[model samples]
Target: MQITASTVSLTVADVAASQAFLTAHLGYTVQAAADGFASLTRADAVDIVLLARGTQVLPPEQRDRHAAGLILAFTLADGLHDQEKRLREAGVEITMPLREEPWGERLFQITDPNGVIIQFVEWATSDDT
Candidate 1:
């Protein structure tokens, strides 16, 4: 009578590469791995899966074209500087310079090997609020 999303899959050039990124950079635990697929579980029961081209139950054309790269949104617990330091120490490439939004958020974006955008954000107090 009810349904909920348990997992989300995104196409990657290489499953191992994506797996390594999540493991090394984000500290997610790798739950499963196969020839061309890997699954990772983070806190709060969230699971992310990487399916390399030519694999997975998703459409063949979609895999072949690698059309379903995703936006992996991450919220920072500490301040913006802390997030910056962590990502910087990991040697992650910064696609857009960090910017403060008028709505009171400090956000930055970077893309992974599979062309998936990873947006990192932290709360920044608004000037008027």
Candidate 2:
């Protein structure tokens, strides 16, 4: 299969709230939006689709489920600290403070209004392979 892009669709209690948070703090722009849905995009990151909870487009069994216990993570080539600082300056609360692991992974996390966890990560070494 040929994949041109990737997207994460999140079932949220408030689509507009998530949309606003992503657009204002995470550099995403609204590609499209309606009463209960929004498609957000950024040039260098995965597209995000926010769907209201209980959206009928999902299968009946899944329609009632909301995004939980999931962490949407972005791995950056560098500037992890700078990104964290920017987010902090924007009044985003850091759920996980910046820390480095023994495996050379530096990371932090934040929770959006809908309780979706987002993580930013960077490698201490160049060998991401």
Candidate 3:
């Protein structure tokens, strides 16, 4: 089968908080929303669906589980530093500082109000590393 698009569904205590954080800080647009659910989209990133804990859309056993121990990462072609600076200027707390790995990967992270970890990454060429 072929896939047309991708989305990550996160269960949070407050759907609105995650929705607002993504839209205000990460450039996501609301595709749809309701009392306990929100669908967000961005042109250059994976779509996100936030569901409040206890939402019936989830299986009975999973409805109480919240998103944790997961890092939603987006890879960028360039401008990693600029993005970090922009977020900083916007008053977003950087949970992980920008750092380059020996393998030539540069990345940083921020935790949304709902405690979801979002990471932005860029790869350096051999010459630059």
lDDT of 2 by residue, 8-124 (tens): 999999999999999999889999999999999999999999999888798898787889989999999899999999999999999999999988889999999999999999888
| Candidate 1 local distance difference test against the native | 0.76
CA error at residue 76 for candidate 1, angstroms: 2.5
lDDT of 1 by residue, 1-129 (tens): 676646777777788887888788777898889888888998764588888787757676686756354577777765766766678878998887788887788888877766778888888654436
In model 1, pairs of residues that clash are: none
User: For every model shown, what is its TM-score relative to the native structure?
Assistant: 0.81, 0.94, 0.97
Model 3 lDDT, residue 88, Cα = 99
The most accurate candidate by lDDT is 3
Q: Taking the tens digit of each residue's C-alpha lDDT, what string does model 3 give over 18-61?
A: 99999999999999999999999998889999999998879999
**Lowest summed lDDT over 10 consecutive residues: which window, candidate 2?**
120-129
TM-score, structure 1 vs. true: 0.81
Model 3's TM-score against the true structure: 0.97
Question: Which residue pairs does candidate 2 place in steric collision?
Answer: none
